[model samples]
Target: MARLTALAGGLAVALVLLAAPAMAHNHPSGITDLVTPAVVRVEATAHVDITLLDHIGELVHVERSYDVPIGSGTGIVINPEGGIVTLTRVVKTDRDVAVYAANRVFAEHHKVKIPADFARHKLKDDVLNHHLQECYPPKTPTATCIINVTTNITVFPNVSPADPKGLKADLVKAGDTLDSPAVLTLSGRVLGSLGMPTAPLADKVPDAAGSPTNVAGFLGRPAPNLPFTVDIAHLRQGGGGDSQGRQFADPEKKVDEPVKLGKLIDEGFLGAPVIGDKDGHVVGMLFGGGQDGRMIGVREITAALAKAGVAPRRGAIDSAFEAALTRYHTKYYTEAASGFQRVLELYPGNVVAAGLLKISLQKRGTAEDAGTKGAVSPTPRSLPLWPFIVAAAVLLVAALVGAFLLWRRRAPEERVEEPPAPVATASPQQPFDEGANPTVVVRRSQPFQVVPRQQPLMTANEQPSVKYCTECGMRLGPAHRFCGYCGHPIET
Candidate 1:
């Protein structure tokens, strides 16, 4: 039980150590990679189909179609089901596409010089100029041109092997302002059942000014040669207001932060997600361009998503990726490899996963791979014989010592049995009985004096036969020197 407890304690410590590296760092070391996979390039095009009516000696009907690119920017996937969040200006344009289409159509059909622009144009001919004015808007029956305009929004994801055609998406919700958050839903087929990778949105913006952040997006269509760009910046004070939008701060003045972001915004990062340095989550979206660049906070993004009836959430791909990331950072390459492989199977061409998986595969089973170390064996080990040997020796010694003690305890109580004592007979001896008889003379002389002399008598009870103990007054055998009942000595 003691060994088991120690083993458990060691395992707990190992787990804590393994998880430490991922939790220790608060800065954005490489966290920008976390959001780059979900970044996508958004392009909006205006499709116009126009019909021109030219009345002349011969009535000719001319129909033509024109594709005009109105807007291009970056966006982020918010959910696994292909829900996207971007700026309204990236998918919706305010220009009069109808007029642009009419201008091109008229120029081609009439073989006349007409500036192909959104503004209304005039012709020297009164009738043609009148027709062009009528084509502007609010269709009238007398108008000489019929035009229909539609916008097509396409999304190119950051994946390998570059999807040349890109996925089709439709605007689901748009904010009040051109730079406000807009929601788009993919109309194309999903890449996988688990859907695409999504960027995590922070619960709230960092309250302090000069908060560090990274802006990630594609400056062009996502491709093998064209990688997503990530730029570091700091947030200015007082973000997310009706008019103040959010501004970038350059404390050191080493670089014009706004101008730097503005240049990227102009290229394609207009709606790029601004990732927070603290936790690598989307705190806001980049907005505006040129000398003054701004951002829209996550609150506005969520609000727009709410209005679109969509919830921002993660999916299976994210779940697998995060699990793998922990193992990778902990140097458990064997386990990490399997986890990364699972992620790749779920979503192929995942750049981060691919890179980590490659490293994991190389490091797996090596000494540094923690997952491969300290593995429990299935077979039980054979215990050493020395302990049992020592135990047996101790038991034998104890038995011998116990036996010797038992013999010593009984030694004093054992006494020898003595032989019986011999009985004694009383006898009298005669004096001078060896010589011849010559003593009769004296006897005659003395006989006359036989006067009355008293003789003492003896009784039968006076015979000397038995002995008694002086201490207890108990009878004793004739040969006994000590009393059997009281252990008293007898004097002869």
Candidate 2:
């Protein structure tokens, strides 16, 4: 049993040693990649349809329709059910699209001079001026034009092959301010089943100034050619929970932070999520643009989501991606590759996982990979002594255990117990004749006793007995030649 136990222990150690090389290469990249997959591009437009009434020279009716671009920016998916958070300005515009459509229609049909813009303009002619004035706002009993407007929102996810048509979403809730957070829900039923990757929202903004963070979002339509971008920045002091929002700056001042982030916002980072460097959770969102760029803290973001009645949560796809990401950052490229592949199976078109998978495959067996180190051919100088020493020690322990078990098994057989010898007793016989020699009965344990032939013998029916010492009267055995107690001699 002990030998079996030792062998089992040695086997376990050997297995662990063999597995060490495979696990040695793991190094984790910080939390940046965790939020990238959930970022998406948001585009909104106001579709306007207008009909103009021309009655001055002739009774003529003209109709026109136009799609005016509202705004475009970035947003983060906050739940598996396709809930999203972005700036209100992305989906809800402040400008009057109806007025812009009315201006263009009047200019084209009436041949009237007017700036085709969102601003209301008066005409030189009295009748046309009166008509245009009526079309400016607040529909009343004396209206001259008919207009209708609808807002259309589309979300392009960071995925492979690119979602060309994009997912349709409706504004669930909008914040009080334009730069504040607005919530949207994807329209289709399939979005809930897709297990979309989601960004985790931090409970509140970091209190300390100069907290590190990453701002990740798409610079263009999500595609292989235009992958999402991530930029590092630090939070500046002040504007913790105010409409003014927070500022970003470089502690080292090596780079002009406001200028740099301004360029990013102008390029397409508007409404991007600001991820906290400490834990990789979203601390705020990139708001505003140009030299006046700022961030909206998580406290306001959650308030908007709460108004929308959508709970922010993670899903299974996140589980798989995080597992793969850990292996990837640890430099376990071979194992990392397999893990990423599993993530893609769970959530296809995952841009982050696909990118990491490609890199993992490339680096799996390279010299930098720790997993491949032990498998490489070794030279005399490159060979290590620890492995050999460990093997020798393991063999020595096994031998000792086996020897002990063998000794224990054979101990009982080697110890032999002798049976008690048969006790000898004297039988009645004719006494020795005529004093030739008096036969003496002796025992090993006692003195001998002698009887003369001239003396009378006992009858045949008498009970037989052993001898005793003549002087000491002590009991004796048949082998005794002298009394044990008295030292008396006896003839044999």
TM-score of each: 0.70, 0.70
lDDT of each: 0.78, 0.78
Residue 444 of model 2 has an lDDT of 45
**Which consecutive 10 residues in model 2 have the weakest lDDT in total?**
432-441
Residues 29-123, candidate 1: write the lDDT tens digits.
43775688789999999999888787744777889999999889999999998999999999888888898888888888778899989888889
Q: When superposed on Cα atoms, how far off is each prediction in RMSD? A: 21.2, 11.8
Where model 1 places Cα greater than 4 Å from the true spot, the runs are: 1-30, 362-492
TM-score of 1: 0.70
